[model samples]
Target: MTTDAVDAPSGRSASFTVLTTGYTLSTGPGVAATVSYVTDGGRHVVVDPGMVAHRDRILGPLAELGLTADRVTDVVLSHHHPDNTLNVGLFGEATVHDHKAEYRADQWLDRDADGHALTPSLRLIATPGHSPEDITLLAGTPDGVVAFVGDLWWRPNGPVEDPVSPDQAVLRASRERVLAVADVIVPGHGAPFRAADALL
Candidate 1:
């Protein structure tokens, strides 16, 4: 429900808004991945448009922001997990970005996510742990760098440990790397939080 913006050299501002704060039920089978909308000049990006309680949770917010799915120029997936990629086709007009490539229509472009700049203020960094294919989106805004991290911390208070991570040590390293630059973190299944408050 809030937007943050940062002015870029090209006189365009980069901005982002949490379209829907996602959630997961600890006691039952329920989960929704946090989805976000980001804009850098003419580029409109959607991050992790995955499973949600309802599609309105995603569309309604975009509509409120004066945008429609067709206007999204790009879609970034954090990993291949169903909870993080199930709704990707929702933005069919968008060129999809994942760990290793970009997909649009029938064209597939091979590229590494790490150090890749999607726009003047949005870049990707490799953060494999939750999944070997995991990547984090780094967005520059007035509030500082906000990282869209997939299940990196789950929540600010911490899952302390990620039970499903292929390598907990690697995950910890990834968390540290993000904390080094991100002032705020948009976790996969929770509202954003201050990076300093994140529990490893």
Candidate 2:
């Protein structure tokens, strides 16, 4: 699965806030996916509104930011895994984006998400390995480019390799692709970390 380099979006810059930091417990197989809120002008995008200790863990921060579920304009799912997509229906009015299409209401617009710009500063790119359908959201911010990479990495230090990745080689390639452009990374089940400090 060779993919082209992800080019940074030009012009505008978006802002992001982690609604809830996530975790994966080594014992009992417990996990919660990190959820984020990104603001690119009028586009309020939520990335991976997955499993959480409570729904408020996902919504409380939004309220703190003066937003409601309906205010979210877009919802992005990195993949269709249950842990990463459990709360998708919360944003009923949002246009949902995945690796291959834009889903809104009754319309399923077939389109490649790679390099698909949701705004001048926010885009999606294909970065599969943890799952064949995985995609990462790239946001151009004032500080630098932030890559919201779902499970491509569990965290900065990592398992060094994903235990469940279908193709280790492809996963390694995807990590390199992200490292080439990202200044910071919002990993799948952890807080954001500087790309320079990654154990990759």
Best prediction by TM-score:
2
- Candidate 1 lDDT, 1-200, residue by residue in tens: 11122211212257889998777787226999899998886899999999998899899999998998899999999999898888888898999999999999999999998878887678888888888999998888866788899887676666887889999999998888888778889999888999888998
Clashing pairs in 1: none
Report the CA-based lDDT of candidate 1 relative to the real structure: 0.84
TM-score of each: 0.91, 0.94
> What value does the lDDT take at residue 132 in candidate 2?
98
Worst 10 residues of 1 by lDDT: 1-10
User: Model 1: runs farther than 4 Å from truth?
Assistant: 1-12, 27-29
Tell how far residue 167 is off in model 1, in angstroms: 0.3
